[model samples]
Target: MDIKQLQADIAAAVRGNDVLKCEVQNALDALSCATPKLKYLEIHVLKKDENINQFTNDLQECMKELGVLKGILPKVF
Candidate 1:
Protein backbone atom coordinates (compact mmCIF):
# COMPACT_ATOMS: atom_id res chain seq x y z
CA MET A 1 0.00 0.00 0.00
CA ASP A 2 3.03 2.26 0.08
CA ILE A 3 3.08 4.97 -2.54
CA LYS A 4 6.56 4.17 -3.77
CA GLN A 5 5.66 0.53 -4.41
CA LEU A 6 2.42 1.45 -6.06
CA GLN A 7 4.28 3.94 -8.22
CA ALA A 8 6.78 1.33 -9.21
CA ASP A 9 4.01 -1.11 -10.07
CA ILE A 10 2.31 1.47 -12.22
CA ALA A 11 5.54 2.29 -13.97
CA ALA A 12 6.12 -1.37 -14.67
CA ALA A 13 2.60 -1.97 -15.88
CA VAL A 14 2.65 0.96 -18.25
CA ARG A 15 6.14 0.51 -19.58
CA GLY A 16 5.24 -0.63 -23.09
CA ASN A 17 2.38 1.74 -23.74
CA ASP A 18 3.08 5.44 -24.20
CA VAL A 19 -0.40 6.74 -23.55
CA LEU A 20 -0.88 4.55 -20.52
CA LYS A 21 2.56 5.46 -19.27
CA CYS A 22 1.71 9.13 -19.41
CA GLU A 23 -1.52 8.62 -17.55
CA VAL A 24 0.08 6.42 -14.94
CA GLN A 25 2.88 8.92 -14.46
CA ASN A 26 0.35 11.65 -13.90
CA ALA A 27 -1.42 9.54 -11.32
CA LEU A 28 1.84 8.82 -9.58
CA ASP A 29 2.72 12.50 -9.44
CA ALA A 30 -0.57 13.27 -7.81
CA LEU A 31 -0.09 10.45 -5.34
CA SER A 32 3.41 11.63 -4.51
CA CYS A 33 2.11 15.07 -3.72
CA ALA A 34 -0.86 13.88 -1.70
CA THR A 35 1.03 11.33 0.37
CA PRO A 36 3.46 13.84 1.88
CA LYS A 37 0.70 16.26 2.75
CA LEU A 38 -1.26 13.55 4.45
CA LYS A 39 1.74 12.40 6.40
CA TYR A 40 2.62 15.92 7.49
CA LEU A 41 -0.88 16.57 8.71
CA GLU A 42 -1.08 13.27 10.51
CA ILE A 43 2.19 13.81 12.30
CA HIS A 44 2.10 17.53 13.08
CA VAL A 45 -1.34 19.08 12.79
CA LEU A 46 -3.33 16.18 14.15
CA LYS A 47 -1.21 15.53 17.21
CA LYS A 48 -3.54 17.17 19.68
CA ASP A 49 -6.13 14.40 19.56
CA GLU A 50 -8.77 16.74 18.30
CA ASN A 51 -11.12 16.19 15.35
CA ILE A 52 -9.86 12.73 14.53
CA ASN A 53 -13.05 12.08 12.62
CA GLN A 54 -12.05 14.48 9.88
CA PHE A 55 -8.58 12.99 9.67
CA THR A 56 -10.10 9.55 9.38
CA ASN A 57 -12.31 10.67 6.53
CA ASP A 58 -9.39 12.25 4.72
CA LEU A 59 -7.29 9.15 5.21
CA GLN A 60 -10.07 6.97 3.84
CA GLU A 61 -10.45 9.19 0.79
CA CYS A 62 -6.73 8.98 0.09
CA MET A 63 -6.76 5.20 0.40
CA LYS A 64 -9.86 5.01 -1.75
CA GLU A 65 -8.16 6.93 -4.54
CA LEU A 66 -5.23 4.53 -4.42
CA GLY A 67 -7.60 1.57 -4.40
CA VAL A 68 -9.49 2.87 -7.42
CA LEU A 69 -6.35 3.53 -9.37
CA LYS A 70 -4.90 0.14 -8.45
CA GLY A 71 -8.16 -1.55 -9.37
CA ILE A 72 -8.19 0.06 -12.79
CA LEU A 73 -4.92 -1.53 -13.90
CA PRO A 74 -6.21 -5.10 -13.70
CA LYS A 75 -9.27 -4.20 -15.73
CA VAL A 76 -7.30 -2.20 -18.28
CA PHE A 77 -4.52 -4.67 -18.99
Candidate 2:
Protein backbone atom coordinates (compact mmCIF):
# COMPACT_ATOMS: atom_id res chain seq x y z
CA MET A 1 0.00 0.00 0.00
CA ASP A 2 2.44 2.64 1.28
CA ILE A 3 6.02 2.85 -0.05
CA LYS A 4 7.57 2.50 3.43
CA GLN A 5 5.46 -0.58 4.21
CA LEU A 6 6.28 -2.12 0.83
CA GLN A 7 9.99 -1.56 1.39
CA ALA A 8 9.81 -3.20 4.83
CA ASP A 9 8.02 -6.20 3.40
CA ILE A 10 10.63 -6.59 0.67
CA ALA A 11 13.42 -6.38 3.20
CA ALA A 12 11.82 -9.04 5.36
CA ALA A 13 11.36 -11.32 2.38
CA VAL A 14 14.98 -10.88 1.39
CA ARG A 15 16.16 -11.72 4.87
CA GLY A 16 14.00 -14.83 4.94
CA ASN A 17 15.36 -15.95 1.58
CA ASP A 18 18.91 -15.42 2.76
CA VAL A 19 18.28 -17.53 5.86
CA LEU A 20 16.79 -20.30 3.75
CA LYS A 21 19.77 -20.19 1.40
CA CYS A 22 22.17 -20.52 4.29
CA GLU A 23 20.28 -23.52 5.64
CA VAL A 24 20.34 -25.19 2.20
CA GLN A 25 24.06 -24.60 1.90
CA ASN A 26 24.64 -26.12 5.33
CA ALA A 27 22.64 -29.19 4.37
CA LEU A 28 24.64 -29.60 1.18
CA ASP A 29 27.91 -29.36 3.12
CA ALA A 30 26.72 -31.99 5.59
CA LEU A 31 25.74 -34.32 2.78
CA SER A 32 29.14 -33.87 1.19
CA CYS A 33 30.79 -34.92 4.45
CA ALA A 34 28.54 -37.94 4.83
CA THR A 35 28.97 -39.25 1.29
CA PRO A 36 32.43 -40.66 1.84
CA LYS A 37 31.44 -42.17 5.19
CA LEU A 38 28.51 -43.92 3.54
CA LYS A 39 30.80 -45.32 0.85
CA TYR A 40 33.19 -46.64 3.45
CA LEU A 41 30.34 -48.25 5.32
CA GLU A 42 29.15 -49.96 2.16
CA ILE A 43 32.61 -51.32 1.47
CA HIS A 44 32.91 -52.59 5.06
CA VAL A 45 29.58 -54.39 4.80
CA LEU A 46 30.58 -56.03 1.51
CA LYS A 47 33.81 -57.28 3.04
CA LYS A 48 31.93 -58.76 5.98
CA ASP A 49 29.53 -60.47 3.59
CA GLU A 50 32.46 -61.96 1.70
CA ASN A 51 34.01 -63.23 4.91
CA ILE A 52 30.71 -64.80 5.92
CA ASN A 53 30.44 -66.58 2.60
CA GLN A 54 33.98 -67.90 2.90
CA PHE A 55 33.36 -69.12 6.44
CA THR A 56 30.17 -70.83 5.31
CA ASN A 57 32.07 -72.63 2.56
CA ASP A 58 34.78 -73.71 4.96
CA LEU A 59 32.21 -75.08 7.41
CA GLN A 60 30.54 -77.08 4.68
CA GLU A 61 33.85 -78.61 3.65
CA CYS A 62 34.63 -79.53 7.23
CA MET A 63 31.25 -81.15 7.61
CA LYS A 64 31.79 -83.22 4.49
CA GLU A 65 35.19 -84.38 5.72
CA LEU A 66 33.71 -85.33 9.07
CA GLY A 67 31.05 -87.37 7.31
CA VAL A 68 33.70 -89.26 5.34
CA LEU A 69 35.71 -89.92 8.46
CA LYS A 70 32.62 -91.20 10.24
CA GLY A 71 31.92 -93.62 7.43
CA ILE A 72 35.49 -95.00 7.48
CA LEU A 73 35.67 -95.40 11.28
CA PRO A 74 33.53 -97.82 13.27
CA LYS A 75 31.16 -96.32 15.85
CA VAL A 76 31.38 -97.75 19.40
CA PHE A 77 28.18 -97.52 21.39
Candidate 3:
Protein backbone atom coordinates (compact mmCIF):
# COMPACT_ATOMS: atom_id res chain seq x y z
CA MET A 1 0.00 0.00 0.00
CA ASP A 2 1.03 3.58 -0.62
CA ILE A 3 2.14 5.68 2.36
CA LYS A 4 -0.78 8.05 2.00
CA GLN A 5 -3.31 5.21 2.18
CA LEU A 6 -1.50 3.62 5.11
CA GLN A 7 -1.51 6.91 6.99
CA ALA A 8 -5.23 7.31 6.43
CA ASP A 9 -5.92 3.83 7.75
CA ILE A 10 -3.88 4.46 10.91
CA ALA A 11 -5.57 7.78 11.51
CA ALA A 12 -9.00 6.22 11.19
CA ALA A 13 -8.10 3.49 13.64
CA VAL A 14 -6.73 5.93 16.19
CA ARG A 15 -9.80 8.14 16.01
CA GLY A 16 -11.99 5.19 16.96
CA ASN A 17 -10.01 4.19 20.04
CA ASP A 18 -9.82 5.58 23.58
CA VAL A 19 -6.56 6.13 25.41
CA LEU A 20 -6.54 3.87 28.47
CA LYS A 21 -5.83 5.28 31.94
CA CYS A 22 -3.01 2.82 32.47
CA GLU A 23 -1.19 4.19 29.43
CA VAL A 24 -1.26 7.76 30.67
CA GLN A 25 -0.31 6.69 34.20
CA ASN A 26 2.62 4.72 32.81
CA ALA A 27 3.87 7.82 31.00
CA LEU A 28 3.64 9.87 34.21
CA ASP A 29 5.53 7.19 36.09
CA ALA A 30 8.32 7.22 33.51
CA LEU A 31 8.66 10.99 33.74
CA SER A 32 8.75 10.77 37.53
CA CYS A 33 11.57 8.21 37.35
CA ALA A 34 13.61 10.15 34.82
CA THR A 35 13.30 13.61 36.34
CA PRO A 36 15.48 12.88 39.37
CA LYS A 37 18.23 11.15 37.40
CA LEU A 38 18.19 13.97 34.90
CA LYS A 39 18.48 16.52 37.67
CA TYR A 40 21.35 14.72 39.34
CA LEU A 41 23.22 14.16 36.10
CA GLU A 42 22.83 17.76 35.12
CA ILE A 43 24.15 18.90 38.50
CA HIS A 44 27.00 16.43 38.90
CA VAL A 45 27.93 14.87 35.56
CA LEU A 46 26.99 17.58 33.10
CA LYS A 47 27.78 20.35 35.57
CA LYS A 48 25.31 22.50 33.68
CA ASP A 49 23.00 24.05 36.21
CA GLU A 50 21.10 26.07 33.64
CA ASN A 51 20.48 23.06 31.45
CA ILE A 52 19.30 21.05 34.44
CA ASN A 53 16.88 23.75 35.44
CA GLN A 54 15.49 23.91 31.94
CA PHE A 55 15.25 20.14 31.73
CA THR A 56 13.48 19.93 35.05
CA ASN A 57 11.06 22.64 34.02
CA ASP A 58 10.36 20.85 30.77
CA LEU A 59 9.72 17.64 32.67
CA GLN A 60 7.32 19.45 34.96
CA GLU A 61 5.47 20.79 31.97
CA CYS A 62 5.22 17.33 30.47
CA MET A 63 3.88 15.96 33.73
CA LYS A 64 1.30 18.70 33.80
CA GLU A 65 0.28 17.95 30.28
CA LEU A 66 -0.04 14.26 31.00
CA GLY A 67 -2.02 14.94 34.16
CA VAL A 68 -4.44 17.09 32.23
CA LEU A 69 -4.74 14.50 29.53
CA LYS A 70 -5.35 11.82 32.13
CA GLY A 71 -8.14 13.81 33.68
CA ILE A 72 -9.75 14.77 30.41
CA LEU A 73 -9.51 11.46 28.58
CA PRO A 74 -11.98 9.73 30.87
CA LYS A 75 -14.52 12.45 30.32
CA VAL A 76 -13.87 12.46 26.59
CA PHE A 77 -14.06 8.73 25.85
Candidate 4:
Protein backbone atom coordinates (compact mmCIF):
# COMPACT_ATOMS: atom_id res chain seq x y z
CA MET A 1 0.00 0.00 0.00
CA ASP A 2 0.89 3.69 -0.09
CA ILE A 3 2.71 5.52 2.66
CA LYS A 4 -0.35 7.33 3.96
CA GLN A 5 -2.42 4.17 4.00
CA LEU A 6 0.33 2.25 5.74
CA GLN A 7 0.69 4.99 8.30
CA ALA A 8 -3.02 4.98 9.01
CA ASP A 9 -3.11 1.19 9.25
CA ILE A 10 -0.20 1.15 11.63
CA ALA A 11 -1.80 3.81 13.78
CA ALA A 12 -5.07 1.92 13.92
CA ALA A 13 -3.34 -1.33 14.73
CA VAL A 14 -1.42 0.33 17.51
CA ARG A 15 -4.64 1.39 19.13
CA GLY A 16 -6.32 -1.97 18.71
CA ASN A 17 -7.25 -4.30 21.56
CA ASP A 18 -4.70 -5.94 23.85
CA VAL A 19 -4.87 -9.27 22.03
CA LEU A 20 -2.10 -8.08 19.75
CA LYS A 21 0.68 -8.06 22.30
CA CYS A 22 2.91 -10.54 20.56
CA GLU A 23 2.28 -8.91 17.22
CA VAL A 24 3.31 -5.57 18.65
CA GLN A 25 6.52 -7.06 19.93
CA ASN A 26 7.19 -8.59 16.54
CA ALA A 27 6.61 -5.28 14.82
CA LEU A 28 9.08 -3.60 17.12
CA ASP A 29 11.58 -6.30 16.35
CA ALA A 30 10.95 -5.93 12.65
CA LEU A 31 11.57 -2.21 12.88
CA SER A 32 14.82 -2.85 14.70
CA CYS A 33 15.90 -5.23 11.97
CA ALA A 34 15.11 -2.67 9.30
CA THR A 35 16.73 0.27 11.04
CA PRO A 36 19.87 0.19 8.92
CA LYS A 37 17.98 -0.06 5.66
CA LEU A 38 15.68 2.68 6.79
CA LYS A 39 18.66 4.90 7.44
CA TYR A 40 20.00 4.12 4.01
CA LEU A 41 16.67 4.97 2.47
CA GLU A 42 16.73 8.29 4.24
CA ILE A 43 20.19 9.06 2.85
CA HIS A 44 19.67 7.96 -0.75
CA VAL A 45 16.01 8.47 -1.54
CA LEU A 46 13.96 11.53 -2.57
CA LYS A 47 11.04 13.36 -1.01
CA LYS A 48 8.79 10.34 -1.47
CA ASP A 49 11.32 8.44 0.56
CA GLU A 50 10.64 10.79 3.41
CA ASN A 51 7.10 9.53 3.52
CA ILE A 52 8.33 5.98 3.95
CA ASN A 53 10.72 7.00 6.68
CA GLN A 54 7.97 8.94 8.36
CA PHE A 55 5.58 6.03 8.09
CA THR A 56 8.17 3.60 9.33
CA ASN A 57 9.03 5.85 12.23
CA ASP A 58 5.38 6.15 13.10
CA LEU A 59 4.99 2.38 12.91
CA GLN A 60 8.02 1.91 15.12
CA GLU A 61 6.70 4.37 17.64
CA CYS A 62 3.28 2.80 17.57
CA MET A 63 4.78 -0.62 18.13
CA LYS A 64 6.74 0.72 21.03
CA GLU A 65 3.86 2.59 22.62
CA LEU A 66 0.91 0.24 22.18
CA GLY A 67 2.71 -3.05 22.80
CA VAL A 68 -0.27 -4.99 21.49
CA LEU A 69 -1.01 -4.37 17.85
CA LYS A 70 1.70 -5.77 15.63
CA GLY A 71 0.48 -9.01 14.03
CA ILE A 72 -3.15 -9.19 14.84
CA LEU A 73 -3.89 -11.64 12.09
CA PRO A 74 -6.54 -14.26 11.61
CA LYS A 75 -4.41 -16.85 13.32
CA VAL A 76 -4.62 -14.89 16.51
CA PHE A 77 -8.34 -14.38 16.21
Better of 3 and 4 by TM-score: 3
Q: Tens digit of lDDT per residue, candidate 1, span 1-77?
A: 99999999999777758777788999999999999999988887656565687788889999999999999989999
Screening candidate 1 with a backbone cut-off below 3 angstroms (N, C-alpha, C), the clashing residue pairs are none
Error of 1 at 58 (Å): 29
lDDT of 4 by residue, 2-43 (tens): 999999998888777555887889999999989999897877
For model 4, give the 10-residue run with minimal summed lDDT.
66-75
User: Model 3, 12: alpha-carbon shift in Å?
Assistant: 94
Quantify how close model 2 is to the true structure by its C-alpha RMSD in Å. Answer: 2.0
Q: How many clashing pairs in candidate 1?
A: 0
Model 3 gets an lDDT of: 0.87
What would the per-residue lDDT of candidate 2 be over residues 1-77, giving only the tens digit for each residue?
A: 99999999999999999999999999999999999999999999999999999999999999999999898787543
TM-score of each candidate structure, all chains considered together: 0.39, 0.93, 0.38, 0.30
lDDT of model 1, residue 64? 99
Which sequence of candidate numbers ranks them by lDDT, best first? 2, 1, 3, 4
